[model samples]
Target: MQDVRAGLISAFHWRSDPPVWPEHRIYYADDSAWWREPTILGELGSSLAALFSDEPPTVVMSPESRGSLLGPLVATHLGIGFAEVRKGAERASDDEVWLRRRTPPDYRDRHLEMAVRRSVLRTGDRVLFVDDWAATGAQAMACQQLAGDAGASWVGAAVIVDGLENSADRRLLMLRSLLHLRDLRRR
Candidate 1:
């Protein structure tokens, strides 16, 4: 765990410039370094999965972006299956049914609709949401709603960097993270 934490911190990079970010300087993260490191890659799954060792989920679910990367690792560590949560219900027809929910405004204040296939998340399955980061937890809220719709119990979320601005969201998501956003902030 110590090695993983050190590896994660050393691998992280943030970018902020006057020309690019004048007043509102949001974190421009470059997290590709750790992805290439063999040791970090090997430890990520086990470290993140250890966060919820006691109450392990039946299935791990994550959004299709970066979450897809970490979710599988946690699932593999826990010896459980992983479900990919898709963003948006782009194609709607009589073909397949999806459990969907519109998220509240995120860090960028953009509302997005996240979805998961009904078949992937079965009824009565315990779901653990794993992701790379959580800024506003809008996506986590949507995930919780989708889990409810599927009749699956939500076991909470595990993330690498938790930057949540609201204490309510922190509690609501039951967020556990390896590093707080403040740990990486410019000091």
Candidate 2:
């Protein structure tokens, strides 16, 4: 995990003027490069897999965009199915369900809607939510709600970076990350 964290830290870039939110000055870590490389993705998947080894998930869910990339890789490594929660105006079929939540203006500062197909997630299924990063944990909370609505249980969350100050207060789900906000900020 330390090696993975080091790699991520070295690869990550920080900027004050983020495209989505320019007012806030913070350490921004771009995960696109890591997602594109198979070896890096595999290593990330392996680390997350080890974190969730004790509690294997039946299904892995991720929010659209970055989550879409990491979720599938982790799910594939764990031999589980991957489900995506669409953001924005994406529509789901009649059988699909949508879960919406309001996120703090930390990153995008907007309302986000996540959807999952009813057929893909079953009741009593253990789900692990995956994402590239978590700042305020608004998105992860929304994902947890989506899982609950689908009658699935949230096992935990796995991410490359954990930026939440009060991770325990976010929810009952355990969170595992390779790097943290402080780690990046210190750099």
Listing every candidate in turn, what is its Cα RMSD in Å to the true structure after a full C-alpha superposition?
1.9, 3.6
Residues 38-138 of candidate 2 have per-residue lDDT tens digits of: 66666887787777788989999988888887888789899989988776635445654555444444466776665676667779999998988888787
Per-residue CA lDDT of model 1 for 83-156, tens digit only, reads 89988766567888888899999878999989998989999999999999998898988999999999999998
Which parts of model 1 have CA positions greater than 4 angstroms off? 18-26, 91-93
Residue 37, candidate 2: C-alpha displacement in angstroms: 4.5
Q: Work out how many backbone clashes candidate 1 has.
A: 0
C-alpha local distance difference test of each model: 0.88, 0.76
List ranges where model 2 is wrong by over 4 Å.
Answer: 17-27, 36-38, 92-106
lDDT value, residue 105 of candidate 1: 93
